[model samples]
Every structure is written in structure tokens, then in C-alpha cells.
Target: MLTVDFDRLGVKPGDRAIDIGAGAGRHSFELYRRGADVTAFDRSADDMKAVAEMFAAMELEGEVPADARACAEVGDALELPYADETFDVVLISEVLEHVPQDVRAIEELTRVLKPGGVAAITVPRWFPEKICWALSDAYHEVEGGHIRIYKADELAAKLTAAGLTIRGRDHAHALHAPYWWLKCAVGVDNDDNVLTKAYHKLLVWDLMHKPWLTRSLESVLDPVMGKSVVFYVEKPVVPVAAR
Candidate 1:
């Protein structure tokens, strides 16, 4: 499911977009569909390979518009491969919490965005994430899972320090919060638990079909118990004199 709202992020056709730490190319795929020059980058070779295959499939199936381009790159988030100011838009969703040097990661993300370009960042919301951690140590204490919980103000301050101006912020995926709570309550990896399994099935169905009731409920609940917190920020454009 999409985390950051592309409309709020102001992504337009022909925009050069980078999805950093892209696990399965969800945002990148959407960008391509919207006629962006899209790059899906992640540290996992398998994910990159899968994303590339999907990009090829989309091209062959004519899923993306003619003007759009898409590619996958395997790379480290702390050090992106592209040169400075390379992208018009950058999306880093549910990624910074896993990085040890989160400040450096933000720096890398900021460094690659062009002047006046926007970045959409999403992280596990503080309350739900804190509840998950409190419910099960295994939820976040494990490798490659969330290493930190961020307050909205803390994240905003970090972005501001990195020279990005916050434009808007919101919460998303409220419907998914209970599913995670169920998992944490049962066991972090307990896929076979009856309740967890049932919840997973419901989540899968919701994602695929998006029934109206759940959609409406989530829209209302999203501002409160949403599992993810999204922030839209932009690099300031310097006038010639300021430059």
C-alpha cells in the first residue's frame, strides 16, 4: 500500500524520482505509472532483481505511460550512487528507523535532491510503534527491524537541520495497526496463530480489494492511530544572489 500521498508530495509527470530503500518498488511503480523517470534503490540484491523484472514486465504490458522510465539499483542508503542534486523528488518510506546513523542517512537523502525538490518520508508512528515495542521485545530488537522510535517534532527538527522545510505531515494505514498489535501480542514471528493468520488474511483482502467500509473507517481513523507518519519536505530554492 502507498504510504506518502503523491498529490501532497507534488509529484508530476517527467519528474525524476528516487525511491530510497525501496523494498518492493511500490512507490517507484506508482511514479512510473504517473510518467516519472523513476529509480528504485535498495540494499537487497534480490529485491533489486525482482523490481527490475517487474519494471520490464510493466514495460512489456504497457502498464506505464510512454514517457515514463524506470530502473532498479542495488545500493546503500547512507551513500546513494547518484551525484548531488540528481532528483526532483525522493521518497524514503519506513526506512530511517532501521538505520543506525539516521542523521547521515537524512543527509544523503537531502544531498541528492535538487533545489526546490520535494521529499516524502514515512516512519512508523511513535505511539503504535512504542506499543509494539512494549508489547514484544522481538518486534524491534531484532536485526533489520526498527531501531528507533521518532516523535513527529523530533523528525521535523532533524529534517529542518538537514535544510529541508516541512510542508505537510499526516498519518496513514490506520487499518493495519490492529494487525501489527495482534502479531506483537501473539509473537513477533508467529504466523500460524489463528488470530494473527485471520488478521493477515483480512489485511491481504483489504489491500487487494479495498472494500468501502474499511476504506471509509481508515480515512477517519488515520489521523489518530495510523501506523505510519508521513512528512513532506522541500529543499529551498536559492535566488541568484543567495546562491
Candidate 2:
């Protein structure tokens, strides 16, 4: 399921967009469908390879706009390969928490974004993530797992310090919070637990079908129990005199 709201991010046709740390190209594929020139950049070679294959498959299937382009790149978040002011839009979803130098990663995001361009950043909400940490270390202690929790205000301050102005904010995936809590309770890695398995099935169904009941419930509960918090921001356009 997608975390960041593309509408809020202002992704338009022909926009140059990069999904930094794109795990499986969910956002990148969405961007392509919206007619963006998309780069699905990730540190994982295997994931990038799969994403590249999917890009080609989508092209063959005519899923994306005829003019839209998409490619997967193996890259580092802390040191993006593009030149400064490269992309019109950037998506950094569920990635910062895994990076030891989150600020540097944020800086890199800012650096690659064109002046006045927008970005959407998503992370696990503090309360639910805190509960996950309290219930099980295994949930976050593994390699590439979340290194630390981020309070909403702390994250905002960091982004502002890196020259992005916060434009909007929202929470998402309220129904998924309890599922994670269940996993943490039973055992973070225990896929065989009856409750966990049942919950996973329900979530899968919800994602695939998005029935009215769950959709309405999630809309109501999002403000309170949402698992992910999203922030939309813009890089300030530099004045000619300042330049």
C-alpha cells in the first residue's frame, strides 16, 4: 500500500520524480502511471533489479503513459548520484529511519530537488512505533531496521533546517497499526501465529479490495491510530539577488 499522498506531493504529468530508497517500486510505478519520468533508486541491488524488470513489464502491458519513462538505479541515500536541483519531485518513504545519518539523507533529498519543487516524506508514527519497540526489540533491531523513533515536531525541525518548508501533513494506515502490534506481541518474526496470520489475511484483503467498511473506518481512525505520518514540503526558490 502507498504511504505518501501524491496529490499532496503535487506530482504532475512530465514531472521528473525520484523515489529514493524505493524498496519495491510502489511509488515509482505510481509516478510512471501519472506520466512522470521516474527513477526508482535504492541501495539494494536485488530490489532495483526487480523494479527494473517491473518497469519493462509495465511498458509492455501499456500500464504507463506512452510518453512516460521509468528506470531503477542502485544508489545511496546519503550521497545521491544526481546533480543538485535535479528532480521536480522526490519521495522518501519509510526510509530515513533505516539510515544512520538521517539528516545527511534529508540534505541529499533537498540537494536533488529543484528549487520550488515538492517532496513527500513518510515515517512510522511515534506512538505506534513506540509500542512496537516496547513490545519487541526484534521488530526494529535487525540490520536495516529503524534505528530510532521520530517525533513529528523533531522531524519538521530537521526538514526546515535543511531548507524545506512544510506545506501539509497527514497520517495513514490506521488499520495496519494493530496488525503490527499483534506481530510484536506474538513475536516480530512469527508469521505462523494464528492471530497474526488472520490479521495478515484481513490486511491483504483490505489492500486488494479496499471495501467501504475498512476505508471508512481507516479514515476515522487515521488521526488517532495511524501507523504512518506523512509530510509534504517544498524547496524555496532562490531569488535572483540571493543567487
Candidate 3:
């Protein structure tokens, strides 16, 4: 499922798009399907390999448009390999909170986006994340788990300071918030817990079936308690003077 709405971000066919920290390449795959020239970059060698394999599979199946191109790269978020103004669109979803130098990562993202290019950044929302932290330290203590929680304003402010003009913000995945809470309460690794198992099944069903009732419910509840807060931004034509 997509946390950032590509339509709202104004992503178009033939756009050069980068999915930073593309864990399983969800956003990258979507961009490719939309006829973008897509790149999925992450530090994990395994993830990059998997993303490459998926890309190859898509190519064999003719899943992407003939004009769409895609590839995977292993790279750091703080020092992306691409040159400045390289991409027309960028997506950094559910990743900043895991980066210790999040501002630097933001700078890297902004540096690579072409003038007037848009980006979508998603992070765990503060309140629900705070509750999870209160309930279980393990939620934030793991090697690559979330190191920070972001209030919407704080994130937007950071992006603005890094040279992006924040355009819009929204919450997403409301139905999935309870899944994380349950995981934290039981055990982050304990997928066998009965309640967790049941919830997982429901989530799987929701993702696959997408019943209208649940979709409408999630649309209503997303603004209030969604787990991820997504912000849309554009790199201005001219960089603002550093304060």
C-alpha cells in the first residue's frame, strides 16, 4: 500500500524518481508501474538484491510500461550517489526516523531533486509512536528501529530549513497503527502471539481484499490516529539564502 499519494505529489510518466531507503521497494515498484524512470536505493545489500530480482521479474512479466525503466542501488541516505538535480521526483518513506543524521539525509535528498521537483517524506507520527515507546522500550531500542518520533511541524520545519518548500501533509495507515501497538505490547519479534497473529491475518485480508467498509473507516480515522505522517515538498527553483 502507498503511504504517499503519487497523484497529490504530481508525479507523471517519464519522471526520474528515486526511492531512498527502499526497504522492499514498494514505492519504487509503484513508480515503475506508473512509467517513471525509477531507482531504488538502500544501504542493505540483501534488500538491493531482492529489489533487483523483483525488477527483473517485473520486466519478464511485462508489468511496467515500455518507456519505464528501473534499477536498484546500494547506497547511503546521507550521501546519495547521484549528482545534484538528478531526479524529478523522490520518495523517502518511513525512513528518516531511523537515520541518525536525518537532516543530512534530507539535504542529500534535496540536493538530488531537480529544480521544482517534488518529494514525499513519511515518518512515524509522534503521538502514537510516543505511546508505543511508553509501552515498550524495545519498540525504539533495536539496532535499526526508530530512533525518533516526529511531530508534523518539526518535520516540515526541518525540510524547510533544508531548502524544501512544504506543500501539504497528511496521515496514513490508520488501520495499521494497532498492529504496531500489539507488536510492541506482545513482543516486537513475537509473531506467534495469538492476538498478534489474528491481527496480522486481518491486516493481510484488508490489504488483499480491500473491503469498502474498512476503506471508508480508515479514510475517516486516518487524520486522527494514523501511524505515519506524510509530507509533500518541492525544491524551489532557487535555493533560499542560508540563515
Candidate 4:
């Protein structure tokens, strides 16, 4: 499911965008459909391979605009392969919590974004994530699993320190919090729990149909218990005289 609001991010056709840690290429695929020159970057070669296949499939199916382009790159987020100011937009969602050197990755994000360009970043919201941790150690205690939970203001401060201006912030997937809590309570790996299974089915249905009742409910609940907190930030463009 999409987290960043592209309309708020002001992504338009021809924008050079990258989705860092693009696990399954969800956001990257959206970017191509929005007519962007998009790159899906991840450390996992297997994931990148899958993303490449999806990109080719999208192109073949005419799912993306004619002028749009997409590719996948496998790399470290702490050291993106591109040069300075290479992208008009950058996105990293649900990724930083897993990186031990998250600040370095943020700095790399600042370095690669063009002046005046925007980036959308998301992390698990503090309270909900805390609940998950409290409910079960297994929820996060695994290789490549979440290593930390972020408080919104703390994340904003880190971005500011990295020279990105915080433009906006919001919470998303409010309806998802309880479902995760249930899974954590029952067992992180146990889908056989009747209540958990029922909740999972409900979530899948909500994802597929997005009925108005659930949509409106989630909108109301997001600020209270949203699973993910999103930030929109911009790199300052120096005036000619200042430069």
C-alpha cells in the first residue's frame, strides 16, 4: 500500500525519482505510472531482480506512460551510486528502522537530492511500534527486521540536522495498527489463529476494495494510532548570489 502522498510531494512527469530500499517496487511502479524516470534501489539482488521483471511487465502491458523509464539497482543505502543532486525526488519507507547507520543513509539522501527536490520518508510510529515490541519480542528480533522505533519529532530533527527542511508530516494506515497488535498478541508467525486470520482477511479486503466506511474511519484514526509516520522534506536551493 502507498504511504507518501505524491500530490503533496508534487511529483510530475519527467521527475527523476528513486525509491530507496524498494522492497517490492510498489512505490517505484507508481512513479513510472505517474510518468517519472524512476529507479528502484535495494540491497537485495533478488528483490531488485523481481523489480526489474515487474518494470518490464509494466512496460509491456502499457501500464506506464510512454516517456517514463524504470530500472532497478542493488546497492547500499548509505552510499547511493548516483552523483550529487541527481534526483528530483527520493522515497524511503519503512527502511531506516532496519539500518544500523540510519543517519549516514539520511545524509546520502540529502547529498543525492537536487536542490529544491523533495523526499518522502516513513517509519513505524512510536506508540504502535512500541506496542508491537511489548507484545512480542519475535515481532522485531530477527535478522533484517526492525531495529528501532521512531518518535516523529526525533526523526524530524535528524532530517533537519542533515540539511533537509521538513515540509510536512502525517500518519498513515491507522486501520492497520490493531491488526498487527493482534498478530503480535497471538503470535507473529501464526496465521492459524482464528481471530488473526479473520483480521487478515478483513485487511486484505480493505486493501482491495477500500470501502468508504473503513476509509473514513482510518482517516479519523490515523493521527491517533497510525502505524506509519511520514515526512516530506526538501533540500534548500541556494540563491545565485549566495552561491
Write down the TM-score of every candidate.
0.98, 0.99, 0.96, 0.98
Better of 1 and 4 by lDDT: 4
By lDDT rank, best first, the candidates go 4, 2, 1, 3
Model 2: CA > 4 A from native = none
Across 106-224, the per-residue lDDT of candidate 3 in tens digits comes to: 99999999999999999999988988998899888988988888888899899999989989999999989998898989988897899999998998999999999999999999999
Candidate 4, run of 10 with poorest lDDT: 1-10
Per-candidate Cα lDDT values, in order, are 0.93, 0.94, 0.92, 0.95
lDDT of 2 by residue, 51-143 (tens): 999999999999988999999999899989999999999999999888889999999999999999999999999999999999999999898
Please report the candidate that would top lDDT against the real structure.
4
Residues 1-243, candidate 4, lDDT per residue (tens digit)?
899888998999999999999999889989999999999999999999999999999999999889999999999999898999999999999999999999999999999999999999999999999999999999999989999888899999999999999989999999899999999998999979999889889989999999999999999999999999999999999999998
> Would you give me the overall lDDT of model 1?
0.93
- Provide backbone clash counts, one per model: 0, 0, 0, 0
List pairs with backbone clashes in candidate 2: none
The TM-score between candidate 2 and the true structure equals 0.99
Please rank every candidate by TM-score, starting with the best.
Answer: 2, 4, 1, 3
